[model samples]
Target: MEPNATTNENLNLYEKAENYTKTSLELLKLKTVCSVADVVSTLTSKIAVGVVVAFFTLFLNIGISLWVGKELGEYYYGFFIMALFYLIVAIVIHKTHHKLIKTPIGNTIISSILKEKQN
Candidate 1:
């Protein structure tokens, strides 16, 4: 082939490769967004569960404290004990919430996003 013609063909091939790379990057971005959305959905579902459980816990705590006060004949100590118990329960729930956020569903979504990025 002529020198100019060969150079033009090389330029064309370079342009095509650049275009493919751009397209692939865009697709990866889209996949990452979709995976993030999936993770958010999972979090939302778990949050709903947490809310219900929290309300139940609240009622149970109140009822138990009231019962203990009546039985033990000491309202002040009953209240203090209830407060301590709730503090411990809150700490446990906080840790559990963190763990749940890193669960398989969340990890899978994150992994998919990373895989898309790598590709």
Candidate 2:
């Protein structure tokens, strides 16, 4: 009877440990899903905004380029000026992209993933 009681106790302990492990794994999975969803949603919204802004800028530039060409008496002159301006801007961005773009974007993603839920 004593041996039987001890065996039953051990079995109960094992079952409790198994339950704990399964619960822990489920919690981990939930947290992972939450973090991924947060990151994806944040990125999706930003991309949408970026697309809208890009279209607006495209039309604005085209209008400005045409206007400038009209004023300059040659349509291509306005485009050339705009192209030169963009070339310079691109060169500057290329030089500082790591500092101005990459680090900030990386930090934003990391923060989104690590940010705790409010509720």
Candidate 3:
């Protein structure tokens, strides 16, 4: 083979490599965008659900408190009782933060991201 032909072949190979690199970069960018969108969507939905549940819980607590107040003939005692209940619950959740909330949430996000990658 002539030296000039060999040089031409090298240049052609370089061009193909550059093109491949650009294509790979674009694919990576697209994947990153998709991953972000998926995670955001999951979090948004979770937040919406959480808000709805929180509202339901709040109203339920208020209703129960009012009923208890009527029974006890004291309007404020029921509120205190509800507050105490919530305090205990908060403490328990704080103590078991990792097992009850953190780990599961982490695993869920990771799994969802991985699942998206697989697709």
Model 2: weakest 10-residue lDDT segment is 110-119
TM-scores, each model vs. reference:
0.67, 0.93, 0.94
Candidate 1 or 2, higher TM-score? 2
Pairs with backbone N, CA or C atoms under 3 Å apart (clashes), candidate 1: none
TM-score, model 2 to reference: 0.93
The residue pairs found clashing in candidate 2 are none
What value of lDDT does candidate 2 attain over all alpha carbons? 0.92
Task: Kindly give the number of clashing pairs for every candidate.
Answer: 0, 0, 0
lDDT value, candidate 1, whole model: 0.82
Per-residue error for 17 in candidate 1, Å, reads 1.0
Give the Cα lDDT of each candidate.
0.82, 0.92, 0.92
Candidate 2 ranges with C-alpha deviation above 4 Å: 117-119
